[model samples]
Target: MKISIITVCYNSDATLEKTILSVGGQTYKNIEHIIVDGLSSDNTVKIIQKHQDKIAHWISEPDKGLYDAMNKGIEMATGDIVGILNSDDTFFSKAVLSEIALFHTKNTIDASVGNIIQHKADGKVVRAYSSKYWKPEKLKIGFMPPHPSIFFRRTLFNTLGFYELGFIIGADYELITRFFLKANISWKYSGITTTAMLVGGLSSSGSSSYQLITTEIQKALTMNGLYFSPFKIKMRFAWKIIGFLKK
Candidate 1:
């Protein structure tokens, strides 16, 4: 199956080249690389244009925000499978897409996901978040596959729709909740490393981290057709603390 990998960027000249080269160097030949730039003031568009020959489709224009650019890329994607690789992240290896293709072909999976290595700016390993074996109920407690490590059938969008633009920070989590909890799509865990995300991302860098997690939990519950219970939310926070302590 052909895979469409979309990278969204804005003023990411410093690290965008690495992301582009990583995808261009992939062993998988049946992949399309689409870059959506947000009219960057820096040399981001120039950098993307420099490799335009290898890029399947690219556009540099003003967008509402990150998710808006992502939605634009989704509209331009023409593949059986779709994935996203942010400007600050890279595939784990040259064979990453090849491995994903093989796993999906053998298992007939609608979605494939694996682990993610969170790295500091200096490239030091900060932590590894292993997606728990997929379970609908576990999601209530803030369990989700790393967004960048997920590759799923493109048709899912035709049915479930794109990321909710209303959510600024927790849209990806809400999208996953809708897919796994509401639609009940069959997803497989690859048990392999998929992507390395640079630290200081949206959720980890700012004082908004706390608000993001809280909003994520609320959105997850709402999307799953569940009502939020103050007690349950407190318990979820408590469970997170326990997990952090164990680590």
Candidate 2:
């Protein structure tokens, strides 16, 4: 099965090359690497040009935001399965895509979620986030599998629609909730470490982002007709702390 992996970036020159190399090194051969750049002023486009041979489709232009760029990538994707990898992130191993392909080929599911490890600029591991404990019911508590580790069949997007452009931080939350709870899409845990993410991204930055996401999560849950409570959402942080401790 072909897998289309999308990488979105703006001024991501320092890290984009590694992300490209990770995808290029994948053991799975039938892969389509799509790059969506927000008209980066830096050397991000140059890096993309450097690895142009590895990419199947790419575009450099101004966009609304992250989700908008992702929507563009999704529109260009023609593979059987679609996945997103941030420009600052890389696959855990060359076998990562292979694992995803095998998992999908074996299991008749519409989507899959794996695991991710978050790290700092110095490469210090923060926590190992797993999808093993995730269930559709957990959306009420604002918990979700690592976004970078999730992959969906292209048909899911066609059936459910792309990421909602209305959200700033909760577009992914809204999309996941729509797929799992609202639309009742089939998904399974892949039991593999798919991506390694850099810390300090929008959702992982600090208190301000946390507060904003908390508010947006409420908005997302409400829009989906799911129950929402600020108290329940805050408890997700406690669960995160426990996961870090266990890690």
Which candidate has the highest TM-score of all? 2
What is the overall TM-score of model 1 with all chains considered together? 0.93
Error of model 2, residue 65, in angstroms: 0.6
Clash pairs detected, candidate 1: none
Over the full model, what C-alpha lDDT does candidate 1 score relative to the true structure?
A: 0.84
- Candidate 1 per-residue C-alpha lDDT over 42-76 given as tens digits, one digit per residue, 9 for 90 to 100: 99988998988779999988998888888899889
The digit string of per-residue lDDT tens for model 2 on 2-55 reads 999999999999999999999999989999999999999999999999999999
- Score candidate 2 by lDDT: 0.92
Estimate the TM-score of every prediction.
0.93, 0.96
Model 1 worst lDDT run, 10 consecutive residues: 227-236
| CA lDDT of every candidate | 0.84, 0.92
**Deviating ranges (above 4 Å) for candidate 1:** 228-237, 244-247
